[model samples]
Target chain A: MIRTAFFVSGRTAITAEILGHSLITQFDDVNFRRIVLPFIDTEEKALQAVAQIKAQAEADQCRPVVFSTFISENLRKLFVMDEALTLDFFETFIGPLEKELERQSSHTAGKVHAISNFEEYKHRIDAVNFATTHDDGGMAKNLQDADVILVGVSRSGKTPTCLYLALQYGIKAANYPFTPEDFADHRLPKPLHPFRNKLIGITIEPQRLSQIRQSRKPDSQYAQLSTCEQEVKLAESLMQHERIPFLNTTRLSIEELSTTIMLKAGLKRRCY
Target chain B: MIRTAFFVSGRTAITAEILGHSLITQFDDVNFRRIVLPFIDTEEKALQAVAQIKAQAEADQCRPVVFSTFISENLRKLFVMDEALTLDFFETFIGPLEKELERQSSHTAGKVHAISNFEEYKHRIDAVNFATTHDDGGMAKNLQDADVILVGVSRSGKTPTCLYLALQYGIKAANYPFTPEDFADHRLPKPLHPFRNKLIGITIEPQRLSQIRQSRKPDSQYAQLSTCEQEVKLAESLMQHERIPFLNTTRLSIEELSTTIMLKAGLKRRCY
Candidate 1:
């Protein structure tokens, strides 16, 4: 049975969605139509959300599930409807936290994604700029400053992973593609020699790489299965020869790749 | 008092960090030294995390806070420590969800950010590439295909916002900077005329714009406050004349800005 799951929050609803997704993803057998109701900070907005939830429930002929992170007690109470199953994150944790910490909960909202610290916020933006400048071996001179430089064949999930690292963790991630020239050379690129410690190789299955490249450039020589196999084999061998750690991105998402790279490089996140 | 807060998970621990940040941000008075422990799928890893938490608690002279999203019942038990306040996300929500949904949760891990749907995953990657290629008026001919086009003064947060929209929501976000030439014309850029509905103006406080420009090109005319003010005024006027909705990005993070823009543009997310 398909049910509607509403993720309600006082602010961006990002946290509510994250928490809700974690719970809902467990029930993979059931399909859920996810709806996000952000900035529902008032009783009126809460009432509106309630009505929407009821309407969806009526349409689906079942109770809609609501996962909320509303800190306002009044706003939270408004969502406690008989028409839906309400799971309030703050209500479940805040009171316990208050007692444990020996302090009353402030019960404020919208601080999760706010620019609470300017220095850190700017640091993240700078990281993103750095990644952009250094993408696809651009600005190789700046490789010395990169927290981690990803080496891989083109379309082996380098660009997105670098961007993810920069955007998510404030880590200056530079990625260099393993070109045909580099493959023929049979050695690490000269520029990458000095910063061996900061190098992480990304590898993908030849079949998968061919499929991805085919999507980008259909019927091209680069997208041929044979070409993909040779390039991936060469890239993996070079990484292994250099003793550089690598990850296969065939099954992993960008988030997983970035997180794994951060851990492997022992790189500290500049911002949370 | 300062305390160490460990965000532990069986997978990337990203959700744990998000949920923990949501809860901990409520207590502005307390300082938290946050640490993320991802990929703790094994009992040994959980035990190590428990030890780390204990060490942090002893060092801080108080119990550390542990926010975990481990789906494994065995791994979950290992985190239950006398030296830390353990808050398990799955433990708190799964049983209640089962009761509410009238279905059993699969009790799986690492599916939250997985590429479950290949088509959606490719769509997200394509969006990112589109945002990259069409960034800063690179491909004016491709603007017609864009889901939303962001027009703003340079350094008013056009690049990061576009990138965030692409990476997070899989929205084809192309940005065009209102340059001196456009300001001289006292009108919207000619390229943006065809797709007015796809336009969203990004504006920042003159002071903030100046600061951002100064960081990029210190001591340049573009970094001057007066130049920033003039550019911003002209951009705002053009946007108002063209009836384009705008957002002030001075206080918003990329996530907040992108979310708000998606809402304003009525752009449905292509990925969850």
Candidate 2:
């Protein structure tokens, strides 16, 4: 296998790896070593990255692939003489957009990953707080404030999906757990009655939920497959009885689950 | 404000909105109504999007700005005849990378945001589990497997930062709470003493901490500025005394805080 060293010029390695992965991972027989260049903020940092890249290339016997989300033209110029396969994010999108919009590009690095707009940033922070505080039916009193309240059994991917909704869309997502007693109640839970419009019931395959529970609590009654099946069936019946909008978490990823939740709830994202 | 409509062709509106937000939001005195194109999977979906765009344009009396992260060339061709300033993601980066890497682009829509790599995807799910379970020392008993542990006073942003690190980088991050009592010890908490090397202390300014606490527990003793001040000072000194790496989260965003934490700890991203 051909080993490829990867050098990224950004404050963090996230952007470079995200855009690069979908593109680069398709290449067969190539092992990628992702090295986030130390102190990549200015012209001096750019030179330091180059020096490190040069040393890595000599050791590896192959030119490193440089993926840049760097915005400044000054910073991009420093890498022009470097011998590497460069994928520049700003150079690719900015020029065309500047001409198209008839405006100047901001050329700001880490725009997507950074807090470029403090309002949107704060929205995310608030959403995080809301999701965490309202998690696992922790604060039933706070349910009415939630934009969307996710209801499901414990260990059924509720917490992660709610957190994703918070982080990605700045949606105030709260989740409530259905216990054995709550599941036995033929009627809807009393706490969830007032905000039934906000309730979106989540269910999962018994096997999957069992496996998840077993991972957390091995060989316990909670981890039993029979218990999972009974709970999931009861939850589904309750959702139908209550006429609640429901979704299956058996196959959906967290992002997909959050999107579908928003779509079903008809909730608008507070911030992008 | 002029009413301008917009269309994006992708599996999800998320990537389109995220990359488009920073660049598009800068335009002053213009209102944008972004319409995500109807399922762009076939020729019919393309025609549906065109019809919707046409109706929206007619209603708004302005030519729209179209941003396509649509991967298929066939689908892209359908938009070529449309009258709008198109911002294409594939046409920009794929050509250069194709030439440099000597591989054809996958041309798949939503590859980056979707479950392109299952291993990386599973890492995120597991990291999220690790983060939620170990949050605020809830599962301090399970700290042996954590890649890193975050310690901070209440409302100093430990939970959100840990979650961000988990979601973004797939790092197994656990956060421990430090009360005034623990901080008075002038060293790491007893439970965290074993994982001292894995510790990354987090601090926030007293004013910011007070504001955050006030929002959570309004008018409470925890929201008092003096309490915040005393707690923060002790935490910072404890970190210094133990030679533990720390960062102030008052001005830093979640992205910046996670990046700084990783850099200070010399931690590599466990997954993308």
Candidate 3:
């Protein structure tokens, strides 16, 4: 049995669990151990955890691949020095983010300005709040309360993106349907109109959208090859005309789509 | 104006934004610059970000404290080495979690399993799902679908917790109101009797309950301190006699209470 352990350290326990579960889902036929140690606030704890994993690996006679999020340098160094552990995926993944944060830090210095236009931002917040309350299927409301809102047609990875946003960010994110109704109207739904600035549209390659929809609805007009092409064209045109920023959810995980959308929308980020 | 930039690197951008917003709420007078750098998946990118922040700090003449989550170590080290930045709070918080994960890796070598027992944990998921559905003031339904049904008086944090569990862990947590009608009848609601083994009770301190109730209905009997106290006492005694596990949500955050109840009920964790 290949032994794997996910060490998630963050302010939010729920976020760690979601990420751990998703990572576990990527592997097949592997024995996985998930232990959540919350409130990891220091370097000493990181080292102690490393020592424990090293001992466990020797006892089990198996090399361990440790997947960790939010570990400190002092402890990470101890793991790196050990010859037994094979991989440190967290270090590999976070490498880019840290660098970017540093570069951006200088550019943003003295640039952080509060919304003196609190009234404007407040209006935006209220619009979103209204959109959330008015949405049907209880789904719209769920996403409207989201720190970020994703607008897209069916199967553009809205549900998954919403779930990822909620699960990973603990943000109440809502996705609204860009249905035929919205398409024919040639405008965002009336409820979404006021929050237009916060409105982000998600588009996808027509072929990809069709493929995804095919899995769910197969024979419907919504999933038909031609219909998908037309819808994509129409949605893109609408977003362009209205000047709403949109993203292609095709070939992206819910994580990727949400990150791109949030970036484009300039939504406040909760997680680092 | 003290400018603060939030560097978010995570799977969910909206979550990052919501967290950013929440953090912003913590300060009374600070300039907040919201920068959304998405799809940051490499160390070099993190370095670039660090450089950017450093420049911004020099320009602003104030060292910036970065709020980040899920950032990598190589990047974190780069930031730490850079004297331009003052704090990386997420990095500090994740330190301990890394160590704990390393320690557990040995004992549970390859034993960590991502149990697809969502079906088994369906009740908990249902309850949460129900709460989310009901939280936006939707109707309670599919009581038959609940796992361990929760019955309590209103304002018990039932809806919030249920939604949290569902949205966070995908637990199917269903909650029913122990209305005066149900109490007068001296029986569990009709649908809940069949799932008695799955029934859990929730109660709150009378004063807290009164306070919460007052928010929705000021000057109502239900919001009276005495009335709340009576209901809580009755609910507690009844649950004890019925052998149902119960929790008091008065002091617990929705997260802590949910974890405690799930553990006490032996409910399989839905997320991790």
Candidate 4:
């Protein structure tokens, strides 16, 4: 069994934890013991953490792996000096950035060149705000302001895609629910009727949707396999009649969904 | 006026654009003369992309930066063979991840971990569902289910934090507006009456809030200096009365806010 320790120092411990989790998920078929050294803010604290890990490793008769994301250089250097610690996975933001600057020395125009696409960045922020405010069940009058409307059944990953588009691309995305009532009526949601051209549908494989719903409402009628299939089929049929462009959200992550939506909606990519 | 080019390839073109925008943000100076490359799948297409980037860089008399996320290994090797074009900056996911994994081998357990607190991850997913059902208006009934409830004036970065927690930690976070009505009454939002303990308030420097708000609603009363000051003072005072824990979101990124909220709310860190 290998022993590992994560040394985190930042204004927030949660960031460290999230990063730590992401890192650990990569390892497979290993008996791993883990420890978190949170709030190691000072160089002294970092050195102490190294010493502790070294002593623990010696006691256990195994070298301990130490991963750190501390911003302090002094702390980082102290850990680097420790021979017992076999690894230091520190995420340093400035080093690569500085190298890029030095390489582009002759072409350095100023910060304005760096932010040539500021307007697009601003628009992405606006899009996220628009999507957040114009969510389903709101007043009908607000729907007119939507640039693109997303309609989907529950557990179809609509909300996340909308937020991503808004936060990242600055598109005005509004999502409306395709409920039993809409399916039964063989039409889009009432609020989405006026903006049919801008309407985009999201669908997922019924089994996947069922599994997602099952986690939240196990053994419920709404989460039944048959019910999920029915809703998906009905929603797809309705979308076909309405001539709405749709994307499958089953295999795609939120990032992919947002990108597809932006491309299909003819919205200019803001960030690039 | 040095000319530069960026060769980008990914699963989607928009992702390449967003990444390009992020890279531009990192550089303080430099003029990117043009960006060349296509968004394509398959190794053959990727090699074609490499050839195009090499030719462009040579013509421009500059070593272009090639930025890619997911491309074939054959294409990666092809780019490496060319010394004139600096293909090192290609932002492929695997290279850095592999480096991190190898670096991690000598450390704790030699596993690259996903950084996240797991409980917070579960809570974030719940928060997405909760946020969908309850917006600023439905804060009361949904307050009970929230792992951490955030309340603040507009542009306090409440929604982003809530969404980040939901997406990253799968926490069910709900947010309520500390609107003028709530402030005048010197109480939490009507919906938050029953679950005061779960409530957390977000505060920001009035000036910063005003600046952010001004971007959305320039010259509006809501974005005015005095108006922001009044709203902040009232919101903080009301939070104090309700005995809700609060954090200042002024300088904290979305990552920081979500993490801090997780810690303060006593949610177990899930990923680390």
Candidate 5:
């Protein structure tokens, strides 16, 4: 049995959980207890965490494991005074990082992702706006401004990838769903032709594509496995003909797809 | 005159950039050189990083500020061999964390945000599918399954927030655009009544809303400031009347807004 605790100087729930979830997968049959200590900017609050850990240790007959992202050394030291074990993410990493970056860590809190830089936040909003407007490539007539234009058959992971790129990287990504007409003619969509250099084609296995479309339009010709197979085949040929870099998203997550697209297209991210 | 550098064991670009950007804003005169050393799962790669850091140090005529997130102590020691200053995110923090969790650090790579667990990844995709199918509310018409329903005027940050909740947390979020007809009556549309318990209202400042709408529909009545102001006011009143938890997205970013909604509504995230 294991008792895992999370403590941070700021709202470290997101960061801690991200690491914990991965760790949990590796070790099964472990009892997990998350002791979240947020806003521990002072030594007093830190000692309070010590008390909680001590209490848990007494009850469990063993020391609890603590994962922390606290920015303050003094506050972290208070936790170290307790019987519980610790994983001090900030203190452990900051010194070497100071050397690597040629500067000292600011030891700042709440800057992990949100409310840190207004400029970066605004850039994300603008990217989302751009993505929403240019979605399906029909709403926005201006394709030249896009950082990357994602082309794919309907429901081939274009829209979600575009949204991920916009929300995560703040890149001006626009997605155009290739209709059957475009597939038959063996050409890129009309508006997308000018932005061929920025095009990234996304396709899925025909079986998976059919599964997705079947949920949307059951018993329809559009949802037929044959139609899905045909569209995917044509889209891949179109991408090859145009020399556009494409990825099959059947097994890849959106993060993988977007990162690969970012590398392939060399699209600079505006924000994190 | 400051030449800052970054190094990490895992893919630390996202984490490094988040902290680095905040540090950059604090010190505007510094130069940054990000040297990402991903896949440092072995001792060989870690030594290669030492070589790269040494070259940069000699060329720049100054010791570089090194920020590292390497999870291995043996590999991290290789960097200490180099002339660059160091801040070790992983090594500095892992011992205490091991104590906290009562277990040793796993030192896993390629799992920070992606490819950690396929089940979690699948949940996120399913949430995205649920969100896209349920987007605009009218499209899905199945409100009972939604983890949360977002009601707001057009371009009030509803769609993007829904996507964010879906992609990031794997929460089944759906959004509805409150139309002019709903605004005229100063009430939520009839369709949203059944899912009142799952509703989270999002509104933006009229000025910001107008700005966003203007980009989508230039010089239209929908994009007018007056229209924005009126809709926002009516939406707020309707939220008040219905006792829905609402947020003003003008100052808050999408992440912040969605997080607050998740907390207020007590929605358990399906995935990380």
Candidate 6:
């Protein structure tokens, strides 16, 4: 079955989408087409959103499910429609939170997305620049500034994981690839030796690594399964010999890898 | 006063953190020390998390707030503690969702982080690679493959926005900086002429742009206020003459800029 869902919010609607997605995905039987209504902080915008949702529901011949994070009580009521199912995040949780915390919510609109803390925001932007500059062993002189350095075979999901850590968490992540020369021996790379405590090794299963490499470069020695197996085995052996903690990215998503890396490395997330 | 909060989940606690952070931030009076306990998929791990929360609560002499997305009923019960205020996202929302949809939720654990859609995952990886290669006007010959091209003066928040769009939304974004040469003339650069339809202009206020540039290259002509004003004025005028839709990124976060760019370009997000 196809269902229409609206993720409504007074701000960016990102929180609404995250909460809504986590809930709606549980109903695996229905395919949901999500529409995001962001920046609807006023009564007029709320009314327009209601009309839009009602029209969409009527056109689809189904009651549209709305998941909202609107903070204003008056604006939240405007979204109440007889033809649609509306679930307000703040309404459901805020009262209970107030009781527990012994204070009412500030009820501020769009504060979550504001760049209120310039220092923290600037740190995140600087971290992004750092990750980009140090990506794939691009620069080693500034390795000391990195919060975490990722060591892995090429195409073992290093770049994206580093970037995610940098952008999402304000983590200064740098990555280095194990080349053919490095696989000849068990010694850590000279540049990485000084930052042993910050190193997190990432390895992938040979078959998966081969498939990934094959997509990038077809019919090459670099993409052969035998070469991949040899490199991965040697990489694992080196990491074990050096007592470097490692993760297998064979069956993990980037988010999983980054989160696990943060935990394993004991790195603090500089931003929320 | 400072309070402790735990964002716990069976998978990556990203959703938990997003929801928890959004709610916790509304109470501006109290400072929060946020901790993420992710990959708590087992009963033993859940028990350990509960013990950890209890210990922290006792140490603080205050009850901690626990926000969880544990889909398993058995595991969810393990998190309830007298010393903690628990908010289970799935427990709170899934029942109502099931009742509304007239269906039972799968109640599966950690299904959201699974890389079940390989094609979609691969596309995101490819988009990230594309954005990296084309960052800062590095590559322009393959502009045809770009889903969106961002044009702006240096440090106007183009590279990070492109990377965010690529990693977060699976949009192939390429960025080009408008150099002093481009400012000398009102015409769009030659390479950008072919893909004007895919172009989205980004502008920043002169003072903000000057501040950003000053940090990067102190005491240089590039960082001078007059230079920033001239470049911004020229860029905005040129964009207006070319009828390119633009956004001011001075007050916008990278997430906001990327989302707005996606909307302005009418580009369909290739992945969620």
Q: Mark the regions of model 1 whose C-alpha exceeds 4 Å error after superposition.
A: none
The alpha-carbon deviation from the true structure for residue B249 of candidate 4, after best TM-score superposition, in angstroms, is 2.6
TM-score of 1: 0.98
User: True interface contacts reproduced by each model, as a fraction?
Assistant: 0.78, 0.22, 0.06, 0.14, 0.23, 0.68
DockQ of each: 0.79, 0.40, 0.12, 0.26, 0.31, 0.74
Give model 3's DockQ, 2 decimals: 0.12
| Real contacts retained, model 5 | 0.23
Q: How much DockQ does model 4 earn? A: 0.26
lDDT string for model 3 (A1-272, tens) is 45656443433344445434443444445566655544344667666766777777786676554544443444455555352443333344344434533332221111111222323322333332333343332444334354556677766656445544543444456667777777897887776765677777789898877876775577998899899998888888889888888877554544456556656755643432
Range of the 10 consecutive residues with the lowest summed lDDT in candidate 1 chain A:
A105-114
lDDT of 6 by residue, A106-131 (tens): 99976666665767777788888999
Model 2 chain A lDDT-worst window of ten:
A22-31
Candidate 5 docking quality: incorrect, acceptable, medium or high: acceptable
lDDT of 5 at A134: 84
In model 6, which regions exceed 4 Å deviation? none
What are the per-model C-alpha RMSD values against the true structure? 1.1, 3.0, 9.8, 6.2, 4.4, 1.5
Question: CA lDDT of A12 in candidate 1?
Answer: 89
- Score each candidate by Cα lDDT: 0.89, 0.76, 0.56, 0.63, 0.72, 0.89
Candidate 2 lDDT tens digits, B194-235: 889899889999998898788778999989999999898888
| Interface RMSD of each candidate, angstroms, one decimal | 1.1, 3.0, 11.3, 8.3, 4.1, 1.3
Per-residue alpha-carbon lDDT of candidate 4 for residues A73-185, written as tens digits (9 for 90 to 100):
56666766433443332234335434644653222212111223436544655665777777664445787777788888887877777776765555778888888888887
Better of 3 and 4 by TM-score: 4
Q: Write the per-residue lDDT of candidate 6 for residues B41-114, one digit (tens) a residue.
A: 88889889999999999999999999999898999998887999999889989988898899999987766666
Question: What C-alpha root-mean-square deviation, in Å, does candidate 4 show against the real structure?
Answer: 6.2
Error of 5 at B13 (Å): 4.3
